[model samples]
Target chain A: MPKIVNHEERKRKVAEACWRVIQKKGIEQATVREIAKEAKMSVGSMRHYFSSQKDLFIFSMQLVMDHVHERIKKLPLSGPPIKDAMQVLSQVLPIDAERRLEMEVWFLFTSKALNDPDLKKKSDEMDDELYQACRLIIEHLTVAADWKQETERLYALVDGLAVHAIMRPGRLHPDLLLSVLENHLKVIGQNV
Target chain B: MPKIVNHEERKRKVAEACWRVIQKKGIEQATVREIAKEAKMSVGSMRHYFSSQKDLFIFSMQLVMDHVHERIKKLPLSGPPIKDAMQVLSQVLPIDAERRLEMEVWFLFTSKALNDPDLKKKSDEMDDELYQACRLIIEHLTVAADWKQETERLYALVDGLAVHAIMRPGRLHPDLLLSVLENHLKVIGQNV
Candidate 1:
């Protein structure tokens, strides 16, 4: 029996190429021709999946968020809630090659999204997810402190690390990021 | 008296247009035509100050940095070191309309700078200024700790606030950011 091609998977392959194009040449150059070239597909083939560059960009940005959510979902749920939470949030930081690219593309796309309403809507959705994630961690800590303040602080630190890691990689190495994160969590009542 | 046109002031007028363009239309659309229209100047007049779009962008970005640095420098210096430092660093966070637009354009322009060499060099210099400014704050603390780690954490928090304020303006309000900064500075040995 012949199997049908997975359309979502095919689209994701093209999105990955979009990331590479954005990474190598900046988002401005993530044109249909460049992305198709990077994806090693003819523009005709790409048109089958994405009718326009805008469509591909939207799909690619959504893919970036989906990947983060998927990774967080697959994380092993163990240890104290705070510890598990740190693990989940660390996915946002550029701790490795893959995560690093995720971060670079995120910054690139977010900047583009700032003035694009369609992309801004998607960006806002991702920001909401991150804000909620921060709130979840603070709630799990069993602290009497205001969750809103702590959430802002925690999220800021996370965002800051993600940015500094990409901008000043030598300074905010993964090890430093972990220590800073752990200390912040501890202050909020983590045992260790 | 026939006063000669002040070239610097004229260039700044053009740069202001650059900010408006980046803020209203996003950085990618900040072309010569768009900026000229925004500045309400003839394209020929705009070209006299910035021969190329690249030069205009670099100058505009530098102007953003200079504006921030100037604001911080003008802040009162006679206070407890921690309190004074907080005031200085808070300039980077978007606490008002002017700062808000400054930050939005900064992010948009910095994203464009990521892939361009001349812009990247200037961007790196600005990053260094921020890192050094963080160090200056840590050094001003009363108690001695590992300045490097403390500097990194503090800077991350500050950066985080600036970014979060833009990305989630509803949540990380200026008051909350001020309180958080005050609390973080206290942890690092602010007596008051």
Candidate 2:
């Protein structure tokens, strides 16, 4: 049998290579050649998947979002509502080594997006979706509450927790993260 | 009287020049030559204040922390505890253009500090101080409560709010930031 080529899978391999390069070196050095080397492929092969660094970055950045959404979709919603909610929220925090890396890369990409228009547009749209997700969770659990204010507060809390947990994981311990989140739910008197 | 040449004041002026360069161009472009041009000083004169970009960045970064501390120190703390706390917290958020610019510069400098040992040490210390400030406010507002956890939550909330408000001021809105802070205070049941 002849060897089969999987274009989608190959492109994803390239994107993962991009992530590894970004992790090992800083974003400043995430050049196409370096990424190709990281992926263990020729620069010519990388050109087939991504013509430019911007295209590669957009795909890699999008991969981060897709990964997050995939986890959310796989969440066990059959558990107790508050527990399920906490579990869902914890998925977004850097509670483990793998998550911490993703969060770090996310921040770097977001910062880079500050100067790149296409990335900025995508970042803004993604943030709006996250804000909406925050609002929906609050709506499901709270009654007679100011959903708007709560959404802002919860969004900020999650964002802040992710940042500290990613940057100072030693201090912002994972168990501590869960408990603080649970405490927030208790404080808000979220319905069980 | 001889013209009084204030070395300390002049150094700050140079730091501010660095900020303008960072803001106008970026942290990467904030070279000594560019900063000197921005400061309207000759490169030879600029060398007198900062031996290298590292020295200049350390000073510039410290100046940002000092500015925040100075503002917090000047806050009127005699009002109701929650209101007073919100006021103190508000100083950290970017409600206006100037503070927003400061926050952007702070993020860039902090990111740059990640690979630089001296800046990393200083960044960690500054972050610890800020975390301590968060603990103090939580302790002040509540009696016999879990100040440690609340401090983490509050710190995260404030930091998250500031990042969003600075980056997406048009959407986050100044009033929304205030109300979100107020809502967090109310959730903790600071006062009736």
Candidate 3:
């Protein structure tokens, strides 16, 4: 009997390959054939997962968002409120290799979103999710930061850190980035 | 007398035209001919100012940095420190039409900096200038903030606000953005 291949799993694998292609080469280089080769599968096999290059690009773009959601969802949160919150939130920035890849892919998709309506719609949803998460964190902390103000600042800080990490990785280290968040939260009445 | 344009002034005008072309179209659409047309000069005349499209792009990228420097220098710092500091920083974001145009062109050039060596050099220089300015602001504030941490965080916040303002103009208003920065700064040490 032949081994059974998990259809969804294979699709995700191909999408991941597409992300790598976009990272190494520009997004335009992420054609179906190139993605298939990167995934170590035949072009026909990859087509079985994605109907066309557009389908593949959309899938890969969705994959980046899904990966972020997955990381945030699975983030281990326990212990003191400030420390746990900081640890969980830190996952969003490009402090390590994995998050760096996600950040690179995110920026690429964001630029593409400017022109692609479908991508723009999805991108808006992600932004809202980020905003909501910040609101929740600020509310949960002992800090009495003004809800509206803190929410905007938190979202902006996340974006700022990600951009710096991508452009000036050597300068903005993980510890330094964490220290900023920690001190800011502490000032607002929370101890990180 | 026929207007005999200075070489340096003509070059600056051509580069400014390039920025307008980028703002109107995507960077890929900003061709030498298109920029020349926007500048209302012959392609030959434009070439005399900028040797090639790459040269034009590099000069345009630097022109933005120069504008930012000029704006920062011009911001009135004679008033209350906190209010004046906020005012100075606000120039960097998309708070007004002029700054909005600058922010838009800055982002467009940023993406190109990834692949273009000439643009990358100027981008790095601008990044350094930004970091230095943020450091100076943190130093001048005489706040209780951990200098290294607060500088990084505030810098990130400014950059983040700029991105949000450009990308989600309707959602993130300029007033709200400034309020957030004010509240965040106040928490650190600034006061009425």
Candidate 4:
């Protein structure tokens, strides 16, 4: 009998390898050949999974998004709106090792997305999702006169904190990240 | 007699060409050979200005830092702390075409700096400068109980606004940028 292979499992493994290559080297080094070597698979077999480097990148990025969505979905929300919102927002921030790696790869892909149309579409979709998420949190928790601006502010703050945390992990600790978010929520909890 | 050439002027020209290349193509395409071609100079001559691609990248990124510093130094304060602070902060944000290009290049270099020690040092210096700038603005403007947290909050917000403006210029307009910053300053003006 022929050997059975799980296509989705193999593709995910390849995408994870691609993420490692990006983290160790840089996105420029994340070519199909390099990823295949990293994944311990032949380049030809790699092509079996992803037809082109662009497709691989798109898959790798989409995987990161999927992981984030999965985590958010699995989060156990408490009673308080502020506490629950903080828990939800923390899903996207680089608060832990796994999320940190995701944010780093996401940052690199976001930069590449600027020049690649296909990657840009994926990047924009993620941005819209985050924006909508922030809007939901704001709409649920705040009675601000201009909730639109509040939503934008919250969205920017989350992204900004994630970038800073990725860059200076020592300085922006997890406690600090939570504090800033909590403070922000309190300030925007009601019309100031 | 031999013709005299301005070294600094020529180097600045090369760096600007490098910026154009980075902006047009991705940073991966900003190789020394490609940069020389973009600058209309021979690769051999390019070595005289920049010893290596790393040096070129450092010089190019430093030039951006210098530009921001020069603009901030030249900004005329309007006496009010909030207004003056907004103007100062706006220099770093992608509020205009020139700044937008600078930020796009900065964002690419920042991502590249992750696995690069030399570039990471330069990136850290810029982060420190921005952090200190935020602290100064907070010190001059607010008496928050925990000024450090407030500083971090403002710093993250400024950077978040910048990244958003770069990614979605159409959605995050200049007026909206100012409004968000202004609102943030006002919120952080007095102790909560």
Candidate 5:
């Protein structure tokens, strides 16, 4: 009997390989050949899944967003309010090497989107998703205070925290990042 | 008599032209030829100032950091502390087209620095400069109770504000950005 491989799963594996190449050696190095080599497949096979370079690029970025969504879905949501909120937010930060790679690729794709129109659409959608998450966190806290003001403050802080984690991981230690986040929760008078 | 052109000034102008090209077009479009065209000179003349493409790229990036430093230096320090801090900090944010261009180019250069060893040295130096500025601001607030902690908080907030202003200009409006910065300074126990 021959081993069976899922086409969709193999496509995802190729995208993941592209991401690793991008994280380790800028996006410029994420050529079809390199990604194919990393995936342990031939360039011809990779091209069978992706018709063009743009297709692979977009799919790779979409795969990144999907991974983030998957991780967020896995977090234990049924917990104490404060702890749960922190956990949900921490899923977005680079607390571990995997998330760090995800963010590195995220940042690279974002810049690349500036030049590629198709990628720009997906990038915009992801931005909205992030803002929506922030809005949800704000609304949850607004039961105690002004939704408008608290929403603005919380969103800024969350955005700040995420970017700091990516830019200066050493200075913005995850524990310290969590403490400041917890402080904001207290300031907003959230029951958490 | 032939016009006496300042060699150093001409080189800076060429670097600035290179930045405009990179920010408007993608970095890949920022070729020596395009930069020369943007600067209204022949490629050979531009070469008189820069020996290679790499030199132009490095100088253009350094020019951005230098410009940011010059702007910060020009800000008047003898004013209401809150107002002065706001003024200085706002200079770093993408409030207008010029600074937006600067932010875009700064981000591009940062990504390039991750893989380019030569650029890495300059990036590390600038990173320290950014960190030192935060440290200085914290030290200045030492008269306040728990100023050490206050500094850390404000530093994170500023970093967050800077990134937000660049990544989501429309979402994080200039006024709101300034308001958050002001409120943060207040929390630092600064009297202004």
Candidate 6:
């Protein structure tokens, strides 16, 4: 019998290697040769997994979003709308090592997307997804007046905290992240 | 007489070129050769201004920070603390084309700084400066309780709005930005 390869698993492995390269060096250095070396695969084989660097980058960034979505889907939303919303939002934050890597990689891609139109589309889609999530949480919380403004506020606060946490994890600890978020929710709840 | 060249002026011109290259292409493309071409200078002469690309980048990034600082310093803060604070914060947002370029370049450098230790120090200093500014505004606002939390909240909100505005200027308009910010301040005022 001949050995068989899991194509999807191999692609995922390569994408993870790309993430490590992006984190260790800046995204600019995430070249195919470098990623191939990082992935412990021959460059020719790497091409088999991803036709081009752009394709690889798109897949890698999409993986980060998929991971967040997966985590959010798995969250045990045992009620009290604010707490459950917090649980959902926490899925996107860099609260743990795993999520931290995802957030960092996600942000690196976002920065790259500024000039790369293909990546820009992906970045915009993710932003819209996050915005919709915020809107959903606001609706669930029953924020009565100016809910649109409230949704924007909540979205900005979440992203700002995520950026700060990723940039300076020591200063913006998980406890403080939860505290800031909880306070915002409480204020919104009171507004209802 | 030998040519009277303004050393500082030439360097400023080169830095401005660097900023344009960064904004147009990504930061990785802001190489000495590319920046020299953009600035309409020879590679040999570019060396006289910045010994290395790293030196040029450092100077360029610092210029962005200095520009923001200069703008804030010149802001005519004819009071009503909340409005004054908004004016100070607005200087950092991408409200105009000039500021939008500054912000875009600033963010690109920030992402690069994650993997570059030398740039990391500069990025940290700017974050601390912004944090302190937020604290000052919070103090001026005289929020009696949890002022620290409030400061962090405000800082995150401003940065979050900035990142969003930079990413999707079409969606997050200047009007919406001010409205969201004004609403946050109103809520904080109510808390006090």
- Computed on C-alpha atoms, the DockQ of candidate 1 is 0.62
What is the clash count of model 3? 0
- DockQ of candidate 2, scored on C-alphas against the true complex (2 decimals): 0.53
Structure candidate 4, residue pairs in collision? none
Q: After superposition, how far is residue B9 of candidate 5 from its true place, in Å?
A: 1.4
Considering only N, C-alpha and C atoms within 3 Å, which residue pairs clash in candidate 2?
Answer: none
DockQ for every prediction shown: 0.62, 0.53, 0.49, 0.77, 0.42, 0.76
Candidates sorted by DockQ, descending order?
4, 6, 1, 2, 3, 5
Clashes of 1: 0
Residue B72 in candidate 4, Cα distance off native in Å: 1.1
Mind giving the per-residue lDDT tens digits that candidate 2 earns over A28-93?
778888999999989997898888889999988888888888988988786766777787787778
Better of 1 and 2 by TM-score: 1
* Per-residue lDDT of model 2, residues B76-121, tens digit only: 7888878888877776778877777777788777666555678877
TM-score of 2: 0.90
lDDT of each: 0.85, 0.80, 0.78, 0.90, 0.76, 0.90
Put down candidate 1 lDDT per residue, A1-192, tens digits, no spaces: 546878889999999999998888899988889988998999998999998888988898899898898998899887887789888988888999899888899889888887898888888899998989888888888564667777877888898888888877887899998888877787677421
Put down candidate 3 lDDT per residue, B1-192, tens digits, no spaces: 767768888888888888788777667678888998999989998887777888888888888888988887887787765777787787788899888888888887776676556787889998888888778777777554467777788899999998887778788898888887886666555521
Q: List, residue by residue over B1-192, the lDDT tens digit for candidate 6.
A: 768999999999999999999999988778888999999999999999889999999999899999999999999897888899899999889888998899999999999999999998999999999999999988877655888788889999999999999999988988899989987887676664
Descending-lDDT candidate ranking: 6, 4, 1, 2, 3, 5
- B91, model 5: CA deviation in Å? 1.6
TM-score of 6: 0.97
Say which docking band candidate 6 falls in: medium
State each model's C-alpha RMSD to the native.
2.5, 2.9, 3.4, 1.4, 3.1, 1.4
Each prediction's fraction of true contacts recovered? 0.75, 0.59, 0.65, 0.64, 0.36, 0.80
- Compose the digit string of candidate 4's lDDT tens values, residues B61-132: 999999999999999986789989998998888999899889989999999998899999999999999999
Model 5 error, position B140 (Å): 3.8
Residues A1-192 of candidate 5 have per-residue lDDT tens digits of 646878899888999999899987888788889899999999998898889988988998898888888988988787766667787777667778887888778878887777667887888888788767766776765574445445556666776676666666777777777777877676555332
